[model samples]
Target: MSASVPRLLVVGGNGFLGSAICRLAVGKGWDVSSMSSSGKPYATPAGHTPAWAPRVKWHAASAFSPDSYSTLIGESTAVVHTLGILLEDVGYKQSVKSGDVFGLVKSFASSLSGGDGNPLKSEEERKRGYEGMNKDSALTVLDTLISTTPPTSTQTRPFVYISAADAFRPVVPRRYIETKRQAEIEIMRKCDEHPEAGVRPTFIRPGLMYHPHIRPLTTLPAFLVDLSAKLSTASGLPNPFASKSPLHGALESLRTYPLHVDHVAAAVLKCIEEGRGGVVEVPEMRDWAGLGSKKKAEVGLQGQ
Candidate 1:
């Protein structure tokens, strides 16, 4: 499915990280197409469309329903799955739009035990929890990718899965990281089990990605989160704020450093360009984009 012009298909492209990937990829001259449930990017506060919106072919469809968007998927030399959920109680968009950070954090705290039931209870239950959104959605799309085209063992198409770096502390549900790891394992198994399928799978695990323009609400928390994460790394100190609030402290230590969304987006393109299959960690993601995590951490801190 490789093309001379380097076409890219971004599943869930209307999202924050997804939108960054689409915008960056378009600037780099890739023929980019985005598919989201909404089929379009969010309008600015002024109710105007972005200039880059016209450059991308937006499709409204679910990744689970490949029949609706397979032609778009198949035409691309590379594909990215950027769809996943953080909490079970509220939708990602709902959490962000409501501007209730503390409430979202409390929701994560409540669901840590995974008592809600197995998210992978069935293929149809793809949004119930971590397993369904993070793991099954990815597997479903890969199934579509493999089944859509005949295997050419030598073709070497690349599929990038947006996995997480995981919570260093127990802030998020254990299933959140577990489900993402499950996706990586299953993706690797599928690609290896079908070498003739010509799909090389890669996992880019980013941590606490923040952006100023898209999700300004995440920036302040990332600043404080980064400070704690750095302290933990440097001195092996526990979260200083633990006595005040253990859950929020753990959330801050979720990653050793926060990442700018655009940097992660750039790293995804770097992974796709290489067409190699493997796990890429946070530090490597920063390096590939020629930016250090510390620098980007401050940028996010400044809300720049």
Candidate 2:
């Protein structure tokens, strides 16, 4: 008989969203393995591992180096690309260019210790950094899958890209949004180029997501955001969280924006379980999580 458990590889398994995916996938009976350059979950300074660390097979691999993960990609039933950075500094980007795969990640993660910051000063620099780390790295993962997975394999392998709702928000930098747009374009380009390859490409555009205990810092802010959203409706004013809003995009996120991190994880798992390909917007993601859909809109839900 055919194997019942699906083999899944999460490229950023130890990260916030990735770890959630790993845990949720495990609960769904998927044989899940996580890949990261560190080859382990992030631990406290005291060296205490995360509680979910033992549930996954951790593999050391860098998204920049496709060779390091070709074997794992070939053997997986589905692969999720959850790797990307929100900040980029010239010095750190230079270090990453010199084969320091973890340098950019380390610096980016450090910046998040406080709040969001953009170090790429110029549009040119932002474009280059976003394309390299976000767009190119994702394409590398797809390249590895295309080269490693045999065409004869009958299993329907879905490639899930963890894109963001901010990609469409006007408050976000245009370069950042365009970078993610480019990545989605590349995924579709590859699908069109290899129609018979059987590699399904899916893009999950999630809104701001926060975990209660996992990221306690955002819990209160999420609460306030949610409150502000409700007040906006009561006041009969324009929705602050609307994508078309030139301002208050970040502010509106408090009420109508942030989703639970587990919701994103569950949405991804559902996408894989059903072998569905296309864009899954925030509302559908929340629906898949059984949180009940707050909105009925779907941005770009396509099918093969």
Candidate maximizing lDDT:
1
Poorly placed runs, candidate 2 (over 4 Å): 1-3, 42-47, 89-128, 167-172, 232-256, 294-304
Model 1: lDDT of residue 124: 60
Candidate 1 clash pair list: none
Off by over 4 Å in 1: 1-3, 45-47, 102-106, 109-114, 118-126, 150-153, 236-255, 293-304
Tens digits of per-residue lDDT for model 2 on 1-304?
1257788899889877888899888887778899988897655333578676687899999887888988888888789998865554545534433435577556655544423335654655543466666787788888888776553557567899988765323333445556777899999899778755678899988766766666654576567665665675567654535555555445444435567888888888888888778998876776666765564345565551
Q: Give candidate 2's TM-score.
A: 0.76
Specify the highest-TM-score model's number: 1
Model 1 poorest 10 in a row by lDDT: 291-300
Clash list (residue pairs), candidate 2: 225-254, 225-255, 226-254, 226-255
Candidate 1 achieves a global lDDT of 0.76
